[model samples]
Target: MSGRTPSTRLADTIGARPVSASAVVYPGKVWDVVSEDVDLGRAGTVTREIIRHPGAVGVLALDDEGRVALVHQYRHPVGMTLWELPAGLLDVEGEPPLLAAQRELAEEADLRAGRWDVLLDWVLSPGGSTEAFRCYLARDLSPVPEADRHQRDGEELDMPTEWFDLDEVHTAVLANRLNSPSLVVGVLAAHASRALGWSTVKPADSPWPEHPKLR
Candidate 1:
């Protein structure tokens, strides 16, 4: 009744594939793997191990100066300290994604945004893992005072955050220099949304069923 009407109901299209059995194969600090016997229409039933992730949120913080904030931190899995947007895991039970994004932006980058909206949602390596992400576009930024900023530790202690012009981020995306999925998608989506007069952006509290938590 307010902005854009909700789209078609996409649920129940695919009937649930009967899960005969499931068991936890491994459990880690962040995620858990469970093996399941899943029914396949023509292929019969098959056993598969799926990684269950708690989901994540990425914040594309942009200042009124037209600069995008970025952070450089070590990614142990890839053995490289890559540049990325302010992001974090959604491990807290019952915490809304928008609130999580707000907390992450403040904690990781010492920044705050007055306006927030859904940029995009994606599933990374859906074949093996349930690592889904919701990226938010944050604007009208303000810097938190150094004295009041959150204390850092681990990789965060050494992580450096900086702002780059929108053109610079776009160029980096085109040059394939920025490898983080969240950053790349955020940049492209932000560019496209702006071109469309920001009509594509949804409210910060928009429902996201693809974000694993709701699924």
Candidate 2:
């Protein structure tokens, strides 16, 4: 074996193939369906359909008492009401990821954070979508002022908010009870970071080169 340990060797490989043709097949409300003909070096060229998304950010708000803030919202695609981290799309032009996470925390959880760290970054669905997601570990929590709270609408209206022990959430994740991607990944990443004394956490504004730029 080489000198690289598991920690040093564990990383996703990145490469790009030439796309001969690309077009938007379906323009949806939130995202678009894209079709592309990519040139494979050795293998023959292939056409792929992709979901072009605007990306998103999530916040795992941890209080000093070892509890996490979560929101119960209905996801129509999955047809389930899930306990998930406060999260939102990066739809607003020119808004930073950290700012989006902050806004989501305040809007969905009615909370704010004084300190933020990047907990995890992932591709929501690499096989079918260009949706890059980031999760933040937010601490030094405080309630959003009532006057400044965002007006909830649609699925957000009447959404319930609750606090749960981090351990409880972790157990739920392990038991397959929590199905929200953000909540599952954020909770597990937060747990691992905490176990490592937060040494694995990155700055809230850490460089995100993997996130695709939207036109």
Backbone clashes per model, in order? 0, 0
**How high is the CA lDDT of each candidate model?**
0.88, 0.91
Clashing pairs for model 1 are none
Model 2 per-residue lDDT tens digits across residues 1-215: 79765696678765668999999999999999999999987898999999999999999999999999999888888899899998999999999989899888898999989999999999989999999999999999999889999998877886889999999999999999999999999999999889989999999999987787732
* Runs off by more than 4 Å, candidate 2: 1-9
Question: How far off is residue 170 in model 2, in Å?
Answer: 0.4
Q: Which candidate tops lDDT?
A: 2
C-alpha-based local distance difference test score of model 2: 0.91
Using Cα atoms with residue i matched to residue i, what is each candidate's TM-score against the true structure?
A: 0.90, 0.94
For TM-score, the strongest prediction is 2
Question: Residue 195 of model 1: what lDDT?
Answer: 83
Per-residue CA lDDT of model 1 for 85-156, tens digit only, reads 999999988898899999999999999889999998888887888788999999988888888899988778
